[model samples]
Target chain A: MPAAEGTAPLAVILDQAGLDGLLTAIRAKGWRTIGPRVADDAVIYDEIETVADLPMGVGDEQKGGYYRLKARGDQALFGYTSGAQGWKRVLYPPRQKLFSAKRTASGFTIDPMAQPDAPLALIGVRACEMAAINVQAKVFGDKDFADPGYQGRLKGALIVAVECTRAGDTCFCDSMGTGPEVGTGYDIKLVEMVGKAGVTYVATAATDKGAKLLKAAKGKPAAEADLAAAAKAVKAAAKQSRKMETATSAKLKDVPEHARWDQVAARCMTCGNCTMVCPTCFCTTVEDVTDLKGDHAERWRKWDSCFTVDFSYIHGGAIRTEVRSRYRQWITHKLSTWHDQFGQAGCVGCGRCITWCPVGIDITEEVAAIHDSTKGRK
Target chain B: MAERKRPKLAVWKFSSCDGCQLSLLDCEDELLALTEEVRISYFLEATRKIEKGPYDVSLVEGSITTPHDVKAIREVRRQSKALITIGACATAGGIQALRNFKSVKEFIRCVYAHPEYIDTLTTSTAISDHVSVDFELRGCPISKHQLLEVLNAYLNGRKPNVPRHSECIECKANGIVCRMVAAGTPCLGPVTQAGCGSLCTGKDRGCFGCFGPMETPNTAALAAHLKELGCSGRDVQRLFRSYNANAEAFRKESETHG
Candidate 1:
């Protein structure tokens, strides 16, 4: 339906063809589209071209130490709860070459790595992931230590967030106050409601750029009925089965020596998978590579994890020698001290850490175990 | 150009496949330039030219399996300024180290027509077990990049920039999916050293751990998870007892299983 009189529509209803048109419009704005795709038996985020590239009929199951992709029976584009990998792989990048140095007769000649030519257009982003992006933005783009590569990628990027209508077993974003519904920071907000309309999507423009792009899609103005249905769907998602006590975020640092840490550390592989999959874990280390002939040298910045023994390295040896201390540092900093440091808890509750861990050590369980044991004790 | 005398490099082999030694030759493009950086004095694989003792850097490959190998390693230690062991065999004990669990006498009787003709040690041991090693490069065949780094670091009088962390770090750094986590495959990446660029996992296979145990590896923790991931006790044991079988952490963990 068209908008009433001369007023522009606040929301639009996008069908199959309209979705494709939206992707085209995003491309027209000179942004490379990236979204979830069914690869390696998991819905991992990669460069996507058409609507066919999306995980349309796929559903994902995630638990502590477990993640599996299954057929959703019906064609629901946003059926999956969370992604195997987060957005950091694109924004901050996994491994980035900082600079390359070559030995000249006069002095050393150094060249910095080039910036990306085109900006990114992230499609099908979840609400929790939006929060994760914001958290990482703060981490990388802070005044004292601004990462140009990260800030540049984020600054020129367009975000299309999809409000989740289903909560996975590992999801606890409702309690974290970050998800199930799109909060601030999204450019375009889409609520995927698979109802009587059959795989319907309510597209609401969150920014002026989003409004101009939505108009290009030529989708119908969203009726009042479609808007209400979308609201009901998000309300269902808000019924989070797995709840992490927000209060636990404040006291996690207090119980550093808690017995629960040893128990959790027993199962923790310390493989650093948790930090790898976490969208907010932004620690990095640099390595210098030289041609064996020693003529040229290149330095690379790689994502480092707190779980590794080398993460706490000094002159003599690593401080966190034991897995227990490393585990304590990761969880403590993620839930508690992060709030003190960044004014927001590090965990966005996407639960990628829980799903991608080889041994399935649940972070929420560890936090709750300590939270319960330390209850009412001043 | 300043007339700086090049350092002497000696490549020695012991009792195993020449795969690790081949890794040096495998630096096909860099090999020629490497010769310019150092004098190819004592490499039997590339050059039959054997130079005198007191070499600048010695790259020793293979395990010390026999009495002759044990004595030779000590002599190599005395001659070389820096002795860097290469591959699983020299650093741990190669696949041949599997014999460390069994009797060498029985094996000789099974393989050889005359058991009396064979003169072999009961166990295959690392170069470090015999003499002082400045460094040890891990892998069934060392990573070509790491080999160059070691050569570059020691030759330039600085510590090698080889990371002693788990393979998981490398896998994540390269955006390789966790085969063990995503597909429920049994992997040794959590316990194995960071090298080989997470080669196996990048190919959608679990890490067989060509690189030996990482520094401060908790093998027992990995073993438990491997078992939970549908690896049987013997399966878990055999997994740890593969290329780097006789490495201390892998050896101890394997012994705990069947």
Candidate 2:
């Protein structure tokens, strides 16, 4: 099961001890590595220095509007799916000050805040989030008005994605064709499988840089059985995952006039939580601020939501005034019009919207309702 | 005219706690620079120097719980070119509006040594109830960024960009896991206005509706959902009766459940 003489190693089997070396290798490359950690009763993405810092032996309970971290006995890392925090915050910060101005003797002098330039190595990224990041890259990296900050962050980072061995209750990435397996958009992809022997990570280098790091980390060249196990693990995860109606994404645009919009709107709070948790949701509002003396002023950009009445405001009033209309706008924009605008679906089906929703409003359920109610009518 | 003078900005307080006014002061990073932009004519929380009438923009906090407050707000509104209400107390009737649901005389008798000494209105009403307001920044204590936005908008002759969406939007944007679904906790986030940066939800708890109800909130649906989540009618009632209990939307919702 060794690699052919001239062929490069496609996969490597890393024992439990090699995780430390992997962390060391990432840090040795002068990258600030961050991954999932158990904090505040949930798995949160944070800075990790060692393997122990990872949410080892932790599994998450996720449902529509619910989340909790529990011990799963086996000391398996990357067992949990998406948490409250995503890589988007690390890439495009929640609150970013664009520029600061000062009152000079002549006039005001504006100074753009220096963007953080350090290379970040994001560990434990799920496949769904990879798709989310791709969607975000399209939005923020739009040719016309690309966010320099986002571009810089994207350019300076390395993505270390993790294949899901098990999916969360709210996850529908399988149906979305986004996850449970690692395909692309990552430097390295790790699949941790706990076997009868012990925990071993089936690592695949997606880039040359990732390959060098894997070699430096000193994991054994993966056997054929190890590769099979990893693929089997991903398949099992895909089978176990809660799925959405895949056809709904394509049919979403055609059913805007469906009565289900009203029914879903009744339950939709127009809180925009779904958009907020959505990794691809990049709406932002800018605010101008002046100090007490009015001499120095600064403009800041913070996250905004489509659900806000003022988001679609004009001179007379807001366009989407009704809550139902706003909800309709959000769902349509996310599922249907997003393809028209961004050339891709806005949702990655990570289920953050469902898991973070206060009333447990499920996007997949809403879309399914629309699809089902208007199956052949139109 | 010699040179166009700088517009005067004033911050006024009334019946409630000074938290909202303090929010303006909490803009410590921008406070010194803000003074350079507008004259701080009257802000008792930061400075005691009282400026004369006819201020360009007045930021008023608190509710009209006393007859004195009602008259004072009218005078303040009359004197200011643009009067913007800051916080739940100034827009919605604040936490003290629970008094609106009970007998003022009985409450005065119960809390005070002598009911005769107390001179109070039966209801605590927002400034808008008595006088027209240019804008209202809703929150238990308005966000500093939002307060700055309002002041900036007023100064620039534009509308403030503060949102009227519910807390669920903020919670979602923050990527904070939903406590209601995960823990069976009842959250007011769905119907409550956006602000507070999803603080409660980020801290692993349900939103207590500190920002009040969003415009045209469907409380009936939320109430039914809360019931399905094991929140009884009384629990739903109590949830809506939190910070902005007397705010029209929340008040009606609370009454429906009660």
DockQ of each: 0.63, 0.50
**Candidate 1's fnat?**
0.59
Best by TM-score: 1
Query: Which ranges of candidate 2 are over 4 A from the true structure?
Result: A1-6, A101-115, A142-145, A293-295, B1-13, B19-52, B109-118, B142-161, B171-177, B197-205
* Whole-model Cα lDDT of every candidate shown, in order: 0.86, 0.81
Write candidate 2's Cα lDDT for B1-258 as tens digits. Answer: 122357898889998799999988898987876786789999887887988988998999999998899789989988999999998898888989999998989888889987788889999988999999988899988899888877776665666766677777666556665677566778888788887888888888888998888866878878998998888899999999978999998899899886
Among the numbered candidates, top DockQ falls to 1
Interface RMSD per candidate (angstroms): 1.8, 3.6
> What are the per-residue Cα lDDT tens digits for candidate 2 across A18-69?
9779889999989999888877677877789899898888898888777777
Model 2 CA lDDT for position B209: 90
TM-score of 2: 0.90
- Candidate 1: tens digits of C-alpha lDDT, residues A97-156: 889998888879897667676999999889889999999999887759898889999999
